[model samples]
Target: MSRIFKVAVIGGGIGRAHIAEGYSARPDLFEVVVLCDIDPVRLGNVGKQFGIARQVASFDEVLAMPDIDIIDICTPPSLHLEQCLAALAAGKHVVCEKPLVGSLAEVDRLIAAAHGAKGRLMPIFQYRFGNGLQKARHIIQQGLAGKPYLATIETAWNRDAAYYSVPWRGRFATELGGALLGHAIHAHDLLSYLMGPVASVFARTATLVNPIEVEDTATASLEMANGALASLSVTLGSARELSRLRLCFEHVTFQSALEPYAPANDPWHIIPNSKAAATAIDAALADWRFVPSRFAGLFAAMHTALVDGSELPVTLQDARNSLELVTALYHSAEQRLPVDLPLRPDHPAYGSWLPEPFRG
Candidate 1:
């Protein structure tokens, strides 16, 4: 029998969801042993709500628990790197929420730390785990989608002053970034996941909504490594919220559901260019097996990878690639020039992507 991992979730806000997916959703694979948060009230509330008997106010307590095999980080962006480093050093496997680190340099540092640590780190990109997106990935990997041509991706959602009322929501120091980094990152990640690496990016940004310090709207054009062209647009000012993706390949065109949050879940339209092509797509999808969607699916895959010693469903390099695009988009928009791929340590935005005033 495989060993069941014991988990300690930190930060009670988003951590509540992690408890639901990691512990409640897969009891056989994971045991929710502890909960940690800075706020006693919120922590107690979440612990009682989830029936988690053990609760602690300090992350140090979480790290010191010998029974806790995994440290699930659902904290603010500012605390992620520190918590991840400490958890890994304590010989605990880690699962962290998105916008992994604030900058490319921090990501590099975490990658190096992960290599030397006894434990492994898995960054969450739950959108990639959805059934519909998985089917799309299978079709493309099986060579049924043919050569990619173009992709149009949009992450449009409304966020007014009330949404940013949370102290960290709009600040670069805490939230890390505005719409491009925080809001649309998952959509951009899905784009790269489907089409592969981006070769270059040219973008423009605006602070048209909610008088925030960071941009609330942005647009960018991308050239994929495979020679495919793509465009990305993001806004927190839209009247109607939607996350959409349209991919046009040589053999078929794939359109995702208009789900604002769970766009990759299901009910996608996979249209072929011809009747023969349609047959091929149908054959490819016939072999598709359903996986649980969102956080549950991510945790399930992680459980398999940890127990079976298989490759992670999402990798550190995948996180790096996503951050590379984020860096490029910021560099492009700030410089008013197209930025190229593989941003290195020498890049101006390597240490931090935020502009001068926002860097503090």
Candidate 2:
């Protein structure tokens, strides 16, 4: 297999960042061949900024391009399912942003479509690629962290009326969900990535920060499948913005940097339970190999997976797991009760998680 894969980016907003990461960071692995968006001015501006000659308004144009090997879907959440299905049908691999789809049924359908496609669907959970998190995972895998005990994840950031001026920002149908789905998703996903699958969740949500229909503040208590306990707090109303994660195990406690956007990158403080544990952690991490964080790292891993016929860096199942937690959280908040894991189709919120009038 060749080392390089051609890519087409849909949606101009976050699509510009994906293009830059592909072309600037790992040129040998990815080529940004096309850019698509409904807005001509924004599309042309992004194309010129990135030196991309092909700028089109229709996604079909991207799907029809024979040389594009992958489609990076940076579009709004409402468009993700249809776009992913179309790309897979066109025999191109896909990389999608978070909150993969609005409902569990969509995830199931996408999983089935992926099974028959020539290429695979990879959900973008780039925060999981950072060296700090990777090092933490390594320590845990080596049994140096010991049995997990507790974790606290906080996503405290500010998003005001101006931030939601964009057409889709504050709505449930267009952006899918609010603070829990869009803003705090990465932090929550990182929580599950480090701790393990969540067995249940009891949550509370509010829209106090903004006039948006969706919740801008939320808190959830989680029970991991392995008997670990965790708490997640999220809001778009913080005076000092930050994303923080603290995982405490039997042997050591891992604390991440307070960087609001790239908390997973570095400067993690790993506190050991005892002197012997500290020595062991130092010995284990001494042999750790670093992977570039965010999009670059995700693309590199995708290249290796494609070439070696191995698993994609982030699988569809991973997306489903994240979405399940999302569904459970919303259910718990809406019903004022704790919800169990493995939410089935028969569940009240399985088909659509949006409440009332927003269930369009």
Candidate 3:
């Protein structure tokens, strides 16, 4: 086992969740050496609660600490790139939250920074580490389902007006984008993870459901690399909160719910075209056990990678693929035409995107 490395956590809202996960399970591998937030009160409160010795007002303060090994960014979407780049420049690894950086260009820049520093940068796509999702990945990998034919994702979660009342919650400039950017990112990442790279995308977004500055609902049609088709729907206007992913292949169909972060414990239906595949799937799942939290597991993997020079759980190219989907979605919505993958730097939506009325 390697020595416990020092870590500094940025932001305080959901960043606190990462801190809690870090301090709770992996004290032998990691120690929360510092906590930083723009809000001093929040910094103080989190520091006290987490038994942290150092609380600073800026991420730079945390970065300046010689002992810090990783900078865990739980900050808003808008600030991810800035903090991540700074951390890399200062010779620290980064664990940034989902939607990586706001735009494809920012994602590229962070990737470049990590390359130059020879440091690892991981995006928080925790859903991939969940037991339920992992089981789905296993099913796909083992070819029990044959080649996937279709994927349907439903991210129907409620986010009332009060939820967006906090600063930078629903705005394009800060929160980056809406449900697709914030809430459904995990589902989207999973879709890409399981199905492989999307060849093209067509999407439509609307703000009819919420009064926020960004769209609260969207529907996207995806064509995968292997000719599989996928339909993704994101809505913060759902009357009830539920998340589900259904994948149908030639041999079998698998479906699983949100599973409250413990995907293995969740009930998954694996219906088959024939009974033999069903028997195989049943035997496979019988040995399955739920992993507690996706974030925790991934963090543990990241720790191993940092300490043992192992593989990163989430890679820069993976982040690029996730950002590619977002880039395609925004472009397809803007041009009202299907946009292809491998977006170029010259793409109109590469840097920033805004709807007609909102575009300055």
Candidate 4:
């Protein structure tokens, strides 16, 4: 097994967070070989701070480097598809941040690139590594949840005008969508991960609290393939930022923390509703093993999948499922009707959703 793989990071802000995690959690596994950003100041600052000798002004430079193994994309959502396609075409694996692209068609193109290049592509849904979320996933897969009945996902984060003042923060073209796309994506991914793929969505959105061109608040009702009903609320005008998920089943109940960004690491309360469920859960936990909270756990898993020929936790199909939900949610909001799952290619809102005129 290789001791360290060369990594190049594009973009500075959130890319720095991923770099910090990579350096802190498993320094022996990854090396920060290159840093790329359009802003030379930010690029030089990060390269010097991390002692990474190679500082490039554009992603193309990083892609040209023969030694680079992975490209960690930290740019805005709008840039993901192009960067990912370039990296994969250059024979480097990709680790792009969530909300991969503004449209499902772009996602399909990236997926095709990965297929042709035979390079790995991982969408950063880092919240999956949290201990709490892992625990809930275990219970559900173990049948302790006994066919989920209902679930609720709530993401209320306060992002005032000052928050959107950042140059690329609040525009339809750059930020992609709005509260649902930017803020609540993680929570929504969590919901889809726990429950199954959604079959339909009915949604309404508003730009009430923020001065951005996008919606700051959205409410959506979901119907899952397994006959489970779910509700989702995403907002950026709350008093504080928090996220929580509640799942009710025939035999047990699972509840996760409301922490922003790290909800997966918190403790989850699993209450068995009956003696049979209690015994089943207890037996499962007796054989359970604990995995440490490493930010590069996803990378590690992907590495293992690459070397050992195992299944990747987040696959292209998984990304498609997440993107499908994003597309469906936006379509529902635009048409003001329940948009069904597996949207066709000709759907008017297939690639984007424009906000309606505010009646208020």
Candidate 5:
């Protein structure tokens, strides 16, 4: 029997979903011992809904607790670096949300700190765990997909003024970025997850959707490391929401479902160029196991990783890859030029990707 891991979840917003779908799904693997939120109202509501008897209003209190084995930081983008580092310092495993930190430099710092810390850090990219996406990943891994070709990734979702009315959003200082960082990040991460690393990026971003400081629409051209090209289009103004990935490989083409939030779910349109290719794809997925969508699947994998000392499903480096792409996209848009990947310390935006006015 696997020993249940105790978790303390901070930030009652997305944190609640993590508790509901993740910890609740695997009662044998995890237990939500505490729920922490600065807002007492939110804390009480989420705590009561989840049946978590222990509730705390302060982060310091959560940190000081000795029984909590994992600290899940679902707080805002700005708080992630500090909160995650502190949790690691307290010898507690950490799971943080997207746009892990403000800058590439900060991500590097956390990467360095993680090396010496007692607890492991796992970044959230739950979209990568869906069954349809997993099968595509398996097919590619088995070399049934042959060489990579072109791919089109799209993230078009609605976000009105009310959504940005939250105090921290729609500004570079708080939200860190617009749709690219907050919404489409998961889709972009999926791009890297299956298609491999990006070699260069040429992007253009605009704020035409909402009357806010940050951009809501964007388009980017990418050169994958394996010599494949990809086009990324993102907009928060879509009337009909969609999150889709269509990958055209040398032997087959894989397309995700049009579901906005859970595009990785089944019904993916997978087309093989030949009978032999179709047979190979079938053989590859013959023994495919269930991969629960979103948080449930991610947490199960995390539990196994924690117990058996395996590599985390999503590591800080994966966060780095996501952020580096964001940085390059921002830089390219601002400079009106294509930017190369694997940004170094010497890059101007290495410290912070915010436009000049937004950087504090």
Candidate 6:
């Protein structure tokens, strides 16, 4: 029998979205028993809205709750590592937001911490749990897509002065990164989610789109582990926001819909190299099942994993890989050279990917 996991959600900002779109979407699997926030106004507002009876402004208080089965850390990027460590130490399952930690060193430490803890950890990359991307993943996994050739992914969205009005939005100390970490992270993660591991990367980034410490405009060229090549483009200056992925393989060419927020929804231009490939593709998806998009889909999968004691929907290593890619990109952009993946501890950006001036 599957049990409803009791949750204590920390942080009121994106925390509300997690409760609304994620936990609320799966009532049978989760129950958000507590809402914790440092801000009393936000805590009261979100708690009243969600009808969560138990509200506290203490992270340690929630960590002490023996009834809480999960600690969903929706706090800012900076607070993630500390909260995650504490939550895991408390023997509660954890769900953390993206760009898991500031640096590869911190990620390694968090990974190590999770290993010794009783509770499991799942990173948020909810974008993967969608129809279009899943179908593409299914086709490729079924060996119908053949060898990967090339891919072009673009994450172009707008973030103006008003958006950066929040004290934490543009600063390196709190937000970690600008568009690359905060905005285009999901799209970039989707790149590895579909295309696989990266071998090396050459990147260039600029802050032209906004007056921010981190880069708002960036481009990267990558060589995949599978011997395929890829190009990644990200910006916060696009007039018409769009996120698109075009992947070419020996047998199939897939192009995702140009929806900035929900590119993986449906209606990908799936082209087969030959009629044989077409028939196989059709046969593969003959009994297609509906997949709930975004957080809804992600939370459902997490339930199954926790209940069945199986692998998580999004693993620690998956988060590590995403961060590693980002680290490499930042290093490449700084050095003006191609940087290889599986970065060693000695890498300059391993400790902190922030620029020298911004490094704390």
- The RMSD of every model to the true structure, in order and in angstroms, is 1.2, 1.2, 2.2, 2.7, 0.7, 1.1
Q: Where is model 1 poorest over a 10-residue stretch in terms of lDDT?
A: 14-23
Q: What C-alpha lDDT, on a 0 to 100 scale, does residue 152 get in candidate 2?
A: 96
How big is the positional error of residue 329 in model 1, measured in Å on the Cα after superposition?
Answer: 0.6
Candidate 2 lDDT, 1-360, residue by residue in tens: 467888898988877767776445777778787889999999989989888879999999889999999899999898899999999999998999887888999999999999999988999888787788788888888889989999999999999889899998898879889999998989988988888899999999999998888899999999999999999999999999999999999999999988888788898888999999999989987767887877778888888998888999899998999999999999899999999999988998889888867786
TM-score of 2: 0.97
TM-score of candidate 6 relative to the true fold: 0.98
| Candidate 3: stretches off by over 4 Å | 259-265, 282-290, 356-360
Against the true structure, what is each candidate's TM-score?
0.97, 0.97, 0.92, 0.94, 0.99, 0.98
For each candidate, the alpha-carbon lDDT, in order, equals 0.89, 0.89, 0.80, 0.81, 0.93, 0.91
Q: Is candidate 1 or candidate 4 better by TM-score?
A: 1
lDDT of 6 by residue, 1-360 (tens): 569999999888888988999898788889999999989999999999989999999999998888999999988899999999999999999999987889999999999999998899999998887799899999999999999999999998998999888887789899998777887789888888888999999999999988878899999989999999999999999999999999999999999988888888897899999999999999999999988888899999999999889999899999999889888888899889999888999988999988898898
159-251 per-residue lDDT for model 4 (tens digits): 876788888888877887888888888888888889888888999888999777888899999999899999999888888888888999888
Q: Write the per-residue lDDT of candidate 1 for residues 159-245, one digit (tens) a residue.
A: 988888989888888988889988899999999889999999999999998888889999999999999999999999889999999
Using lDDT as the measure, the top candidate is 5
lDDT of candidate 4 at residue 135, scale 0 to 100: 77
**TM-score: model 3 vs. ground truth:** 0.92
Candidate 5 deviant stretches above 4 angstroms: none
Worst-scoring 10-residue span by lDDT in model 3: 258-267
In model 3, what are the clashing residue pairs, if there are any? Answer: 132-263
